[model samples]
Target: QQQVKQSPQSLIVQKGGISIINCAYENTAFDYFPWYQQFPGKGPALLIAIRPDVSEKKEGRFTISFNKSAKQFSLHIMDSQPGDSATYFCASTASNTGKLIFGQGTTLQVKP
Candidate 1:
């Protein structure tokens, strides 16, 4: 199984601050990297993603920083809010495999 290691099982951030979550993968075959956010009693949804060729990708207040050579990636949430409190997961997918190898997940709490 492809293993993706995520750090800081949990995190606490102040509202309007930045929230960061990191992940590392062991498989080089993994091509696509995406971040997912899950709210209480809700299914996870795609937050943002980055391709191996791109070092970084940003969408609104969310950003994904990827390091292809290091097999690592991270999510950055700017101006984090209480609504952003949720379990975030980082995942990798290989081309045409339709399978995602996800990290353990990081639970974030944004304090106002």
Candidate 2:
């Protein structure tokens, strides 16, 4: 079974708008939750991350809201710009093992 599930395979937003993507997991053993952003012809880069202990974390326009009780997490982009358009992925890893399971992906397009 897939440990994680993501919604809205694609999204579109206007410049200065907000872009949101969500993910859910069933594994309570998951301790590390991270989001990655990838651009065309580039490797996925770590965007933001939050542990189960933390409720939320934000970096500039990027924010990750985590719900440990619900076993879900979501990413929000504020004032999304065209340059921010990229494929975002959410992943979880267990502490006992270094195995990371990733969500399918969400392709975001920020229109200028």
Candidate 3:
């Protein structure tokens, strides 16, 4: 139930286009959800996050839409650039244990 499943193992986008990724989880205990972006040979870094209390959150060109009842969430990258190419992972954390469960990554590539 704690597992987060992400789709589209790979994605290709034209520069300045939009990139979208989806994720779902079954764990009701999960209260904190975060998205991380990782570059090759580096660790993942927090991109944006949304809690169950919020339906959506946006930061700059990045946005996260969450549905508590559906146990689903999605990330949208606007004006995607070649530099945005990287592996993105969606993760969930339960309040009690703070244990984080991550979804399989989606590799996004933006063409010039």
Candidate with top TM-score is 3
Q: What's the C-alpha lDDT at position 7 in model 3?
A: 84
Query: With candidate 2 superimposed using the best TM-score fit, by how many Å does residue 63's alpha carbon deviate from the native?
Result: 0.8
Model 3 clash pairs are none
- Stretches of model 1 off by over 4 angstroms after superposition: none
Q: Give candidate 3's error at residue 88 in angstroms.
A: 0.2
lDDT preference between candidates 2 and 3, better one: 3
Write candidate 3's Cα lDDT for 1-112 as tens digits. 7689998899999999999999999989899999999999999999999999999999999999999999999999999999999999999988888478999999999999
Residue 52, candidate 2: C-alpha displacement in angstroms: 0.8
Give the alpha carbon lDDT tens digit for every residue of 1-112 in model 1.
Answer: 4899998799999999999899999989898998999999999998888889889999999999998888889999999999999999999989968789889999999999
Give candidate 3 regions above 4 Å deviation: none
Backbone collision tally, model 2 = 0
TM-score of 1: 0.96
Off by over 4 Å in 2: none
Residue 68 of candidate 2: its Cα lDDT?
86
The TM-score ranking, best first, is 3, 2, 1
